[model samples]
Target: MAPSFYETLVERNKQYAETHNPAPTIAEQMALGRVFETTLVITCVDFRLNPDQFLQTKPEDQFLISRNPAGRVGPALQEIMLFDVFLGLKRVIVIHHTDCGGSQFKDADIREAHKSRLPDHSEIDHMVFGAFDEVEQSVRDDLHLLKTSPYVPKRISDQSLGFVYDIKTGLLTPVE
Candidate 1:
């Protein structure tokens, strides 16, 4: 009787498109194949921690965002490699947040759950869920992983940084 879930999304997107205007300058740059200096931001898939809000910049600007299970750069290394090689990626910022759902469970727990729930699906056993315990340590580890990865350029790796976002306060603290 009513619109489906995807139909609702289409309607919402139509409404958003009506009010949100595309930046002509950014559009022109993209059209011209111009490579702009941009920072690659790796953050958790958590909806509470927004890269745009924390960085105070629009997506159209010089920011390439990658959201993953725990904000671990290792999982998204292919994308990072491509961006670094072609997208003028000069910096990398890894942001792991406090009170993350990924930190709530261990890898073993997730593996056991998957095994129990999907006994016939043995392929899931090899999957790395990226569940973590220490948020700050995870951030640092990710930063190190990015810095040491051969796929990431030395210039970008040298500038790589780590941060912990406080979901409750909407504040980011640098993780050294």
Candidate 2:
């Protein structure tokens, strides 16, 4: 029989620990010297939208990535608050991408699709899927969210930036 997904993950992790840094390196190590030096990346769950590739960071870059369905700041607020208090966050980068799945669907669709899987259909109503119609605008919106959020400190908010990553051309365009 084929290995279960969990088993496969464990096996792959074992290999990673042996071959990789097995701990934070590069950017993470550098941030240790200064408080609020760590850069927090809020990116999409899409594998093709890997922030490391577009940001010129390596696996060992050890940057913190808070990935959700659409990389929207609303959903990542909790993590951001916690990270700031603990890891001392410096920069908040919001990255949305071209041809993103988040743009393909609406929150209503997500609610309907997930309704069947839940014990109570109305339970799905409370969830936000973070869908957006336009990619660039989404990034800008998230950046604005971070900038205005009272929870996000001025140190982190002032440094917040947004970008739209192009999957086809492998480029990232800043969204002002």
Model number with the top TM-score: 1
How would you encode candidate 1's per-residue C-alpha lDDT over 1-176 as one tens digit per residue? 89999999999999999999676586788898876888888888887777787789875567888998978887888988888777778888888999989878788788889899999998887888898879998988888888788887788889988889888888889999
Q: Ten consecutive residues with minimal summed lDDT in candidate 1?
A: 21-30
Cα-based RMSD of the predictions, in order? 2.6, 3.5
The total number of steric clashes, by the backbone 3 Å criterion, in model 1 comes to 0
Candidate 1 similarity to native, TM-score: 0.85
How well does model 2 score by local distance difference test?
0.83
Provide the lDDT at 98 for model 2.
Answer: 88
What 10-residue stretch in candidate 2 is worst by lDDT? 28-37
Clashes of 2: 0
TM-score per prediction, in order, is 0.85, 0.81
Give RMSD (Å) of candidate 2 vs. truth. 3.5
